[model samples]
Target: MNKLTLFIIALLLSPVAVAATPIEQRMADYNPDGNLTFDAKRGEALWHQQRMVDGKQRDCNTCHGKDLTQAGKHVKTGKVIEPMAYSANKERFTKLKKVKKWFKRNCKWTYGRECTTQEKGDLLKYLSQY
Candidate 1:
């Protein structure tokens, strides 16, 4: 390549890459560890515990079996989704961006609150296991 083209390439690549956002950085702190393992256990408990939603006490296991490898379909919408801990579905989590997004939505749907970092890690561990 010509020197001018090389110089332009160098200039284009010179700027330092911007860092991820604080939320992303904080989320990064959620590596699977003992704490996450513990949280996963707790998440399992929570997933099974019935709670009042729309005046109905229901739980994830009410529809999804204790084993997360089973399939679940949305009764109201008739939409099919994979088992929460299905290994066959692992490729779907290739991006952490999508992982966090789904966690936020699903946790709320199941538990009515955003999961803790440890809980998130635990869920990931449990899913990875299956």
Candidate 2:
């Protein structure tokens, strides 16, 4: 094989060389303790689990909807939320800072506290599947 042909082959395989998604890379940053394990099933359960918010029961599904691929609306504000599934919305989990910002805001709003690292990892893992 000529040098140019080998370069083309390497370029074609470059995507495979890049293993982790941006979300996964962010998760790794959060897991400095090196013991965290993410579970999508747990994340799904968390997404559906309800808690009292301003005397009303709510969960992530209240705003994100049961279908991650479909758009959802805020129960009170009525603001449209883009689809949560990465497949449906390519921008869903692309940025580390934005992901953390939403997690901080949403977890407090939905569960009355920030999510633990495991929870965040699991949620990202679950959403990335779609």
Candidate 3:
């Protein structure tokens, strides 16, 4: 009816507004009280943070490597992992289920505990930078 209403309608139909990546959508959902600001640095730090488990230090990078753009190998299984960056790998973050599956498996293996929603959001933020 009004110019403001028309603008809102246009924005709502816009691709950028409608096409939120699965990861982006998840991070937004993870936000607590709309106050969460996903920090890439914090994510990166968690990526590299070492935790000694069973006399061995492990981190996200232990299997994923430091470069999200490069393929990494699983330390234990010797399976090759795909690049994690959305820019580098188009399939990445395309599906929320896969992301959740890995987060659950990896967090347990590396951190020995399930990651918190904040941690998951932070890690997504970090990977987004690549």
- Cα lDDT tens digits, model 1, 1-130, are 9999999988887653445433333334575343433344665565676778888866776555556777677656766767766455544565667777877987788787887777776555555555
Q: Order candidates by lDDT, high to low.
A: 2, 3, 1
After TM-score superposition, the amount by which residue 91's alpha carbon in candidate 3 deviates from its true location, in angstroms, is 0.7
**Model 3 — TM-score against the truth?**
0.81
**lDDT for every model?**
0.63, 0.85, 0.84
lDDT of 2 by residue, 3-110 (tens): 999999999999888777776677777787879888889888888889985688899989988788999998889999999987788776777789889999999998
User: How do all models score by TM-score?
Assistant: 0.60, 0.82, 0.81
Superposed by TM-score, candidate 1 places the C-alpha of residue 30 at a distance from the truth, in angstroms, of: 1.9
Best by lDDT: 2
lDDT per residue (tens digit) for residues 9-112 in model 3: 89888987678876677777678488877898989888887999888889888888778899989998989999988678877876678788989998898888
Badly placed stretches (over 4 Å) of model 3 are 1-13
User: Which regions of candidate 2 fall more than 4 Å away from where they truly are?
Assistant: 1-14, 32-34
